[model samples]
Target: MRASTPAYTMSRPMSESVAAIVNDDIISTYDLAQRMRLLIATTGIQPTQENLPEFQQQALLSLIDEHLELQELKRVEKDQKFPIILNDQEVRDEITDMASNNKMTADQLLASLKSQGIAEDTLFQQIRASRSWEHWISGRYGSRLRIGEDQIQATKARLVAAASKPQYDVSEVFIDAGRAGGMDAANKGAAQLVAQLQQGAPFAAVARQFSSSSTAAAGGDAGWISPGEMPPQVDTALEQLRPGQLSQPIPVKDGVYIIYLRDKRAGAGQTLVSLKQAAIALPADAPAADVEAARTKLIAVRSQIKDCATLEATVRNTPGVIAGDLGEAETSDLLPEFAEAAKTLQPGQLSQPIRTKVGLHVLAVCGKRAAGAAQIDHDQIENRLKGQQLSMISRRALRDLHSTATIEQR
Candidate 1:
């Protein structure tokens, strides 16, 4: 799992070779090269001399996991006496969707990869393994899980309590040691992922493909989390991070985590307001008489506009007047003077003329959502709960497979 491994570890260097062995299956050197190309192509990681070894190691690791998963799928089918065959069309459909997401037709996508020296069959095989595993896992386990109202209420209560505390908007990439076959492998994989991230790879794309966390489906977006919501190591990492920063791999009991701090907020329960404004253009150095005239003109226009809907029309009729629709934002995001005026106004109420360097302006409060007015998303909560459970089960399943299987890394 370390970078000490040779970049080329071919048992037979004279011909097509094997990177590793998973039970009876051989992961070919050709397979490793194709997967590395795919990883770089999809994640946009800038390949370099220093990072190429890491990429090779990670690609071989991924290929081994896929081999184990495909073997398990077959074993389960044979034991259960059910038809668990992964339909060819399913894999093709997934490829088509991938192509569409990249703004290409299926044939065009294949041609593009071909031009880049990647085989079409390599892509199909990877998709087939992934689709097979996902279908089996979701169908077998997802249908059996049930969430109760008590659980939902408990989660909602926690959210409400956390609303009073500072929250972080974060994304993550988790490498499960169990799934990776050991702590060393997980750590190395996490480091490789970070290298790609640092080199401009898209975090979401990488997370969906590599992270074993429940949030992987959401591009690792762990939104608006307060203290004590994450693991102790993760919390410590977050505490030291400013917005738009990435954390180095943090080792934990089960795996390693990489955190990306997207943003931070004082709290979640801040008041949100929607506003509209009418302004009369005037220079700051204008004479006192001119300022008064602009203020006087704005006051007259404000009287004619009973609410936000009428403000724009009133501004249109008055020359030199401009209207603006300031969309919803937290009160803290607004200017201090504007925030004060907004706090005093109710929906549909107009503010007194306020003077700024740009002009004399009157603001209308379109709407306000009081602190804690945000609704709890029941569906989102349920999905999160289910995803967490599924992620745990998946790791255990893969771990068991790893323990029983014969694996050899060249």
Candidate 2:
């Protein structure tokens, strides 16, 4: 069946307001403002009056793509006859977690945002876009993503041969020099993204919002890269950077690049781990009693962890929790609870109750083993490669949207 005209129409004015008319939905001016405030709050970017306008310009770029992603997702869902929706409670939980991380309660967070004239739904939608895109990518690309045993063995063998040649942890934010308006537009976009990064908007967030590359799906993570994996110019920039330093916009033949150096590692391989875990999620919109009940159950389970020995069975006792093998992972692989848990736990240990926007998480560390320069996990490598491919697919999808849609900025 052909996709129906979207439930929304391009010509109709949104009651909330519109900054741009996407294919059938609107990017409200309010979205841009709230996102700017959220960026400032999350990234520790102070919105000095002088830099605020600069931030706004880049925020719009991010939102434009967000609209495109949602629109495409809608079409994909309809044509494929599957629901493409992000849970509202999950969205609330993300906001709640963000507030907690900043040492504020969700209500206090909302109040603070309102004081700054930011809309609550704007932040909610941003989180929704992020979560939904991740789901779409993983679901859409799970089957075709490739990493054969021979491929892994080859990569591992190559690493073994290299001996001490270091792998650099890298992330990127890209601007297409090949855009229709050409280098001038690309450079301008790159400059705006760089300024936002300097102002404290995260590189990943900025990249996801602005990058023309496929890595935007994973927030521009290029992952652990070998010496020859990148072009000479990008590699050269990598050599000069210490971890946490982001590069200036470097010119490539067809791309403008901003690279973030994450780290460099040797033996025990950045202290990575592989995990199998489960969680029982309480509704983010639930009453206090329900949330506390879930938390209490989580804490009880956490206390019972003698070791990773029986974590799988114990985690599944909760109604909504299901155990899944997460394969091999780095500390950077997960968000707060699991990531922190992976970092601190022994090989068989279980982490304490880590509250997330989604639910109370009890993580089990299935294995924590050293990864030498030559060692690689098949499942993990497959996931990483798949992520890269998904990003590319998403990029192509958005490009199609740009070519076909009408976007009018007011």
Candidate 3:
């Protein structure tokens, strides 16, 4: 069956409060309002008339960009006539995933849409378009991209190093910053609770009884997180704590935090075997000699790296380098240049220097396993690869679409 028109258009005039036009499609003010509400709720931003206008304008521009992308995707689909398509079950599954990410059940999310004056069918239609676009893009571009065994090995090696580092399972108590008297009361209460914890009071019990965050119900558990994943102040406190220690009250931009280190575990799992590497870029207007000098330095750095460990250590020590353990890069996670370099290395080996738009890279091979190494599932790998590729392509496509779109605000 053909997908239905957006819900707002079905019962209302298409011309009413038209925000922008993308080809034949109209982005109405009603659509912008619903999107604004969703963005505000997700970002935890307090809504006000002052900010609402800005939000509405931004949302309308974003919608136009998305429409342009869908139009391009449709053009591709028509040209290729690819047999791959998202069935109704797949569409429903996508909706379920969206709901889960938002911490709501599918029914609850649908009800929330109703509260925002957005019909459930409208959202379903949007989901259909999104899924179809994904399908078309993957079918068109999947084969041209190559991710190899060496790339996965390098990623795995980095993950191993990361696992060797210390980690914490933390719990937090949050108090909303926007509420009147909220910050002061939460700060004082958290300070007292921290003192009580220092005096050996039960942390989880205190958290369950008093925290304002939804995680309070779960004893304020934030789950396992890396230092960079947390706010800087909170990260600093966690840095000083050993496992099973509790931190003093810390103020984040929007809340008060009292954290407890529940446990520590060594990273030795498939999940920890992922790594990401991006070639460092020189300034846009850099002198040719300076760019060449940087490239030569990167080559020298790559030449000394014998494995992922050395590569990671070198990047860590280098002033201008950023590297990460992506926990098992599939072919899709790698840039084309990196993937090509990865294809040449064995485990415990490093590749020759390769140039990309960013700069020069030396991809070091960390480890390799046959398709089912360490009990990693093939289907899981394929899905992860697909998701990563889709994200990269989508972001690029959206940027290009935005560049050409006409946008105005009232």
Candidate 4:
């Protein structure tokens, strides 16, 4: 006979006994409590017993969804005979990068997390889940993507255009009203900071001591950020100042900020590429043979296309095929294979089939423009596309899995 499944337990103090079960995975009351504590601490939101139940339910559901997705990922991989593994060193490196971005040492970050009641092991589990999901995606869908030369060339040209614009390097000392106690206190703090700067105190030294932002540890340095990256008040203030000049207290929503113009430069436009693609979707219950057949057909199409216009026309009448225009995307935005292909193509060239999450794609290089010619990076385009695709696949996968799952909510 098969051995019974293991039990799940938690160590935190909790008023409830159990929360919910995601398939065989149990979400405990203590697990919810720890998550609530971390949420409250990081966001500076007050937690109450009244709100705790709802928070616990929501958090439990989110964790359940994650577990379910992971199960589906594993199932898909097993059927495809794809290896899905998470490297511990990669997880550690990602954690290290997060800490560095926050201007905190790893030890300091761990201490902060502990103070917020977040367990290190919980974080590790989350990281493992994330890495596993990525590996599963690559294993299942990696061969479907083909980025082409025209796509890369278009991206490079866009980058060159973007480089022609103006940009500023700014530093700031932020005193949030909530942290300062009130608007009046925040204003006073900003004024005091201004006085220190005027009195010849080192800006970085004073920022290290008085700034309330995470950037405080980095001497309030924001580091070569574009105007669009900053709040309007800060951006406006910086715009009014010359290089090496400081601004008076600039009031903004939630805070008062003292701004310093570290340096300014003519924006260096980087290379960008744009591609038009046709994608075919596969149903959740589709057989492995059927999926492979579709992949082969798309690959065949890629080999025959000579340019973007021809590729676009070729997919015009195909059912379930989607045409996507990734306009002026950065090198970092396109996949590795796509970016490499983009570097060699002229305008109107067609790329080989590129595989992504949705299905097989045949790319067409629509146009190539120099960077800095325009703001090409649309806010969150890549993220939005990825999220939409993942959501679609996840919904289909979950539906299939749930049909056979024995789920209980408590």
* Local accuracy by lDDT, each model: 0.80, 0.69, 0.60, 0.62
Give the alpha carbon lDDT tens digit for every residue of 1-410 in model 4: 11122132234563666667877888777766665555444434334454454345435644665577667766765787654545555666667865787799766776788766677655555555655665565455544544444454444444444455566777878876754558886787577557657767677755654565546646778665555556888877777889989899999898899888888876655556667776677665667786777777777666666666576676665656666667778666678767766755655666666655545566676655445544444223343334335534544554576668767778
Best-first order by lDDT = 1, 2, 4, 3
Clashes within 3 Å, all models in order: 0, 4, 11, 37
Model 3: how far residue 333 lies from native, Å: 36
Runs of candidate 2 with Cα error greater than 4 angstroms are 1-18, 46-54, 79-81, 97-108, 176-182, 192-223, 242-245, 262-374
Q: What is the lDDT of residue 292 in candidate 1?
A: 86
Per-residue lDDT value at 282 in model 4: 68
Please, what is the TM-score per model? 0.67, 0.59, 0.46, 0.41
Q: Score residue 406 of candidate 4 by CA lDDT.
A: 68
lDDT score at residue 308, model 1, on the 0-100 scale? 82
Candidate 3 regions exceeding 4 Å error are: 6-10, 13-15, 38-46, 50-54, 82-93, 96-112, 168-389, 405-410
Q: What is the per-residue lDDT of model 1 for residues 297-328, given as tens digits with 9 covering 90 to 100?
A: 88888889976878888789998889999998
Give the C-alpha miss distance for residue 325 in model 3, angstroms: 30
Highest TM-score scorer = 1
* Model 3: how far residue 311 lies from native, Å: 29
For model 4, give the 10-residue run with minimal summed lDDT.
1-10
Best model number under lDDT: 1
